[model samples]
Target: MGIGDAQVSAEDLETVTQQLGRTPRGTRAIASRCPSGHPNVVQTDPRLPDGTPFPTLYYLTCPKLNSLVSTLESGGLMKEQTERLATDEELAAAYLRAHESYLAERDAIESLGTQVTAGGMPGRVKCLHVHVAHALAKGPGVNPMGDEALALLKAQELWPAGDCAETAAG
Candidate 1:
């Protein structure tokens, strides 16, 4: 894939491609990097190369992070989050703001003409991977669910806050 104005180095794209096990489509930039200086997340275009209205703005690229998030999902984290959305008014409001922000950012590039945000934002927690990617890309406080997921990862000490990302890449 052509680097273009993706604002990412060729090496970064190469590493991301390897991590994803396939070429990325419409990658606009390296959205986030780990402490080891590897691309942990990427900012993808609203529309993919095939004209697909891709809503996932922040795509997590780290293999370790992906696996950790997958484990969290299998543990019924989404169910817990969804339940919270029904009872927690403050959290639900914050999540709605996060969804609006995500849509603004993506629509600034190209309008998707739909209100559908990634990771089931503004309602439920569908994918922790997308939440984590969003949190890592936009930083904490942007997505409460994403921040909570990262905290869980940190508690388990499975999050790659060091050379683990580099090691996984190589």
Candidate 2:
């Protein structure tokens, strides 16, 4: 199927949740953190006291080539193919790019940190680095684009240990 045509299904989401040992509610909760360590559940589009948007982790779920790769790798479809698919180089590169973008966004937010707020709550935004890492560490059920997205998310944070590369290599 063409890249854009692939879709992430409910089954895929269930698989990811099972693999990660996390519930959807937990995932959403993690996404709502502010820099000051306050949870943003009470505020819609909450900002930090310094005027930064609550740090958010975004994930675009879909089925695509990477999902195929993950399936093949999980099933031991081919030695050569698995080796190429499981390597760290490509993932590392993606992680770096994502990290750069996150840093830039953080800097921009910091510049406007004094103006962010929602209703009466003080803004406390911070980048959601771990969520991105989790996305990057997606296993066999996740599609290729999803994998790339995850890698970008992880790379943004200097390749955090215990996920993505670690799981893939293991």
RMSD of 2: 15.9
Candidate 1 lDDT, tens digit per residue, 49-136?
9998899999999888898899999999989999999999999999999999999999998999999989998888999999999998
Best by lDDT: 1
Whole-model lDDT for model 1 versus the true structure?
0.87
- What TM value does model 1 have? 0.91
Model 2, span 1-170: residue lDDT tens? 11122343465346445544563321322222222222211111224444545543333222232343344345443333224434656643554444444344435534324332211111111222232223333332322333443454356543332232334223
- Spell out the clash pairs found in candidate 1: none
TM-score of every candidate relative to the true structure: 0.91, 0.24
Question: The CA-based lDDT of model 2 is what?
Answer: 0.33
| Stretches of model 2 off by over 4 angstroms after superposition | 1-47, 50-87, 111-170
Q: What is the lDDT of residue 18 in candidate 1?
A: 94
User: Lowest summed lDDT over 10 consecutive residues: which window, candidate 2?
Assistant: 118-127
